[model samples]
Target: MKLKTTYLGKVYSFSNLKELFAKANEEKSGDRLAGIAAETVQERIAAKEVLSTLTLEDIRNNPIIPPEEDEVSRMIENSINERIYSSIKNWSIAELREYILSDNTKSEDLKRISRGLTSEMIAAVAKIMSNIDLVYAANKIEVITTCNITIGQKGTLSSRLQPNHPTDDVEGILMSIKEGLSYGVGDAVIGINPVDDSVENVKRLLHATHDFIREWKIPTQNCVLAHVTTQMKAIRQGAPADLIFQSIAGTEKANRSFGITAELLFEANELVRKEGTGTGPHRLYFETGQGSELSAEAHYNVDQMTLEARNYGFARCYDPFIVNTVVGFIGPEYLYNNKQIIRAGLEDHFMGKMHLLPMGVDICYTNHAKADQNDIEDLSVLLTAAGVNFVIAAPMGDDCMLNYQTLSYHDVATLRQTLQKQTAPEFNRWLLEMDIITEDGILTNKAGDLTIFNR
Candidate 1:
């Protein structure tokens, strides 16, 4: 079977990469050839080319193309990793911050620290970063957090409001965007979830997204919210990196269960920074829900809220540009029902904003859950007053991939017009530039956009 592979993130045929690997000697396996061989091996796994039941014996008899996880490469990687850990293991969080902030330190040094540090270590440093130090070190490492906000715009928090299309149809996406955008929603990037795991599918979705962005000049960035590792692999396979995306959780082990790692997260952050892909500070965007801790079996008997707060700290380490707490997502087991779900959303928002992060609330509930549009609407209005960052604009209040009901486009307009709230600053400027909204913040275009839905 043919497969997609990448060399320096440019996609190529797997057969070609394997041929190159066969010609190369063991001495040339690791940290050479522009990191092509390593990434290609990774891509095949992400593409599901490797059989789950395959073992070393199976590999020996029927070799997988471009051998994976070879000992030579692991040894070299491990040795370097050992050195990075040895240097920082004894350092305190203050010292770690100092090390990051020191003028003598190079960005390459910080990148290495980012790669080698464990999630727990990141959490430790995340908790202690003085607010001033947080901003300073973020600037130093180029880990920006403001994706779409105008800081002094009359206390307006930003939102993402994903109108996720089940089929990944460009038209369906545009249909959803037509409603959400005209409503002054989704100022915070319009990230989508792909129906399939194929990297090609992600590229197709992103390509359509770009066309839509150009057609309307949406004044927003974008990301495909596939698995973190999958998204990273896609980025390596030459997908757009507008915003490196993932779903995060509160506990470290729970995060690992989602296949998220500090290493993968740090790598994606650096890739976007180097790629110069967006108009904002933060590069990564994450969607987290209340019950991931118990879902991963990593809770260790902690309450969902506390573990969820710990998640904010975990997200802070990588300096995500945005994190949306999808409260009430997992159903009765974690959040119990609407009452607990609403409270969870509030608590998560308060904790995230207290950390000075760009936090969004999805204000959603699932089909099997005990909430509905009113529940989401109630939570949405309350969070709006609480100054939470953003909310989803999924069509019909259900994200096809996430299988949960969320805020609709009409819901967003209802909140904004009723409360006289506005979207994040930069987007508001674009709306004014486009005349979609009146100078006084009226959505004069909404009635017009609704005509498309009726058609």
Candidate 2:
């Protein structure tokens, strides 16, 4: 396929699909650090112009990392429905983008087309889309999945109660959970990032959250964000886990750095399916982010956005109950500032949803990034408007364990009220029964009072 274009009388050329993908991306520190970003604005535009013309078959034929070289690439390739692929293989990326945004293309139509796409094709389309283009297109698709409760239904915005403590103290964790539940958070899941990832500590946290959900008869899932192997061991020992948790990456090599393989994930999926406590189907939780591959030195010169899409491709194989991108957590070396972080958050959420994965976003930032609570707040609103499945809520937007700032319990409550969104159906019912919210989903006077749980 042609890879040359002229912008303002200057010809720009990209040597390969990998280079075209990188140069076509919006500015990202990760791509710049990898020494593959476009050298000028004109060059960037030229790259997008060329990328928009390449057919889906061209992208599929020129794999970023060939299937023979990587299991992730292989899995993504193998997952495509040959019949669906053949129907649309001739469409250019621009045609694909317009089709997704067209008034006639309904959500189910996008779902049918997605079965034919590879991660590379998804990334290619996203690169040519503007920020609002990404938003508007993604809003059309709603991916619903179930663990203990259903999420991603229209008019719903869920929150994961991240009751992370610095020391993994059971009481401290429980106290946070109670506080979050009081504010009507945790509809998505009560997930914790443990300071200690040992099997015993993981199991302890799992049992703590599980018991609390049981005692209150809360309609939600519980999980501990530890290594998959550690979580697997805990589950084997009879830890009460409703969903299994792991952080996944785009490349097999980066996944190896996280101590996971496709085979291992398959085994985890089977284990949770047979031994876990969640309801029918869909029981895995995966966290992915841009720059993970480069952090592990396994990016192979691909842009972070494309690699992020590959993360979804691999994740879809197991039909995860929930998958979120911890958007701004990796620091400024990758995302640089609020603008980059915001762009990446929207891109990731849209890509994940386009893959038909029930996607959430950890709208977060580190101390060093040129972002703050306001930036996170801005992104949270944007993603919510885009019909995001869920967002992570820490105690007042600060995580003592992970040492990052994200959306807070108060923020989630405010978002639902301001945007007229409700929690998952079952979780909304629980909130009404607890007197935390009214039948209209507004917070009642009893809301935000932790002592309500004590009574």
Candidate 3:
């Protein structure tokens, strides 16, 4: 395949797919930090130009990290429907991008074609797409998964009630969950990012949140964002949990850095199905970000965006109830600023939808990053318009434990009302029953009062 192109009468060439993929990415500090980003704007465009002409087969044949070397690549390769792949193997990335955006292309059509795609192919198309293109195309695909309730239906927006505490204080965490529920959030899950990952601490949070959900009769799931092994141990010791949470990466080595393997995930899946809480199937929750692989020194010279796509490829194998990219939480060293964060948020949502994962975005940033609440709010709106499955919500948009800012309980309520969207159907019914929201899904006068749950 040709890896050279000319733009503005300047010749630009990339040595291989790995280099070309890195250069084709939108400006990201992670790639630049790795010294793999294009040296000039024209060179980046030239890489995109060359990338656009590559065939699906070309990308498949030139695996960024060969299947023989990476289990993630092998899993992604083995997951493709060879029959479907053979039919569209000759299509160029540009044609693939246009087809996704074509008025004639419906959601079902995209779903059918998605079975043929490899993660690399998906990333290639995303690199050539504009921000609006990412939103419009992603809006066409709806991926629904059910753990305690169904999510990702059109006209529906969900929020994960992230009730994190600075010291794993059960009371503090419960206060946040009560506040979030009072605002009609938590349809996705009442997840906690524990300051401690010990099995005992994880079990404590799980049991506390489980008891709260049971007492309120809330139609939502509960999870503690602990390591897979920790959660597995907690569950084995008889802790109640609605879902198991883990952070995943695009490459095997990065996953190892997190102390997870595909086999471990499979074991956790089995344990959750047999010994844990929640309804039939769809019980895994995965969190990912753009720079995780590079942070672990496992990117294998591939661009962060492509590696992000591969995360979906790995995530799909478990049929996770939700998969969200913590877009800006990786810091300025990777995403840089709000513009890049917004672009990555859109890219990840689009790519996950294309991979048919129940995709969401944690529209968040660290304190030191060159962003503020306004930028996060703007991306939240953009993601909402793109039909995202869910977003993480903290009290007042501040996660005291993680020390990052994300969507607040109030922000979620406002987004739903302003966008004319509803929560998951089951949770929506619960909200009305509790007088938290009106029949039309607007927050009722009684909403935002934690005292209501006191009864």
lDDT of 2 at 268: 96
State the lDDT at 357 in candidate 1: 55
Cα lDDT tens digits, model 1, 1-455, are 23344445555443432232222211111112223223444443332222222221222223221124222112212333556666655564456656766888754577666545433333234333433343344333322246534321335645565767667777887777766676777777777877886777877776677667767666677788777667666667766657888887665567678876667778878877766356556778877776676667765543354456556656766667777887877776665567767666766665564444567787877777766778778878877766565677776666777787888767776777777777767788877876668887787855336463332
Runs of candidate 1 with Cα error greater than 4 angstroms are 1-145, 148-154, 445-455
Q: What TM-score would candidate 1 get against the native?
A: 0.65
lDDT of 2 at 393: 96
Worst 10 residues of 1 by lDDT: 22-31
Predicted candidate 1, C-alpha RMSD = 17.4
**Residue 150's lDDT in candidate 3:** 92
Cα lDDT tens digits, model 2, 1-455, are: 99998789988988999999999999999999999998888899999999999999999999999999999999999999999999999999999999999999999999999999999999999999998988898889999998888889999999999999998889999989999999999988999988888999998898888888999999999999899999999999999888999999999999999999999999999999999999848899999999999999999989999999999999999999999999999999999999999999999999999999999999999999998888889998899899999999999889998898999999999999999999999999988888999988888888667787774
The runs of at least 3 residues in candidate 3 whose Cα sits more than 4 Å from the true structure, single-residue gaps closed, are: none
- lDDT of model 1, residue 368: 75
In order of appearance, the predictions have TM-scores of 0.65, 0.99, 0.99
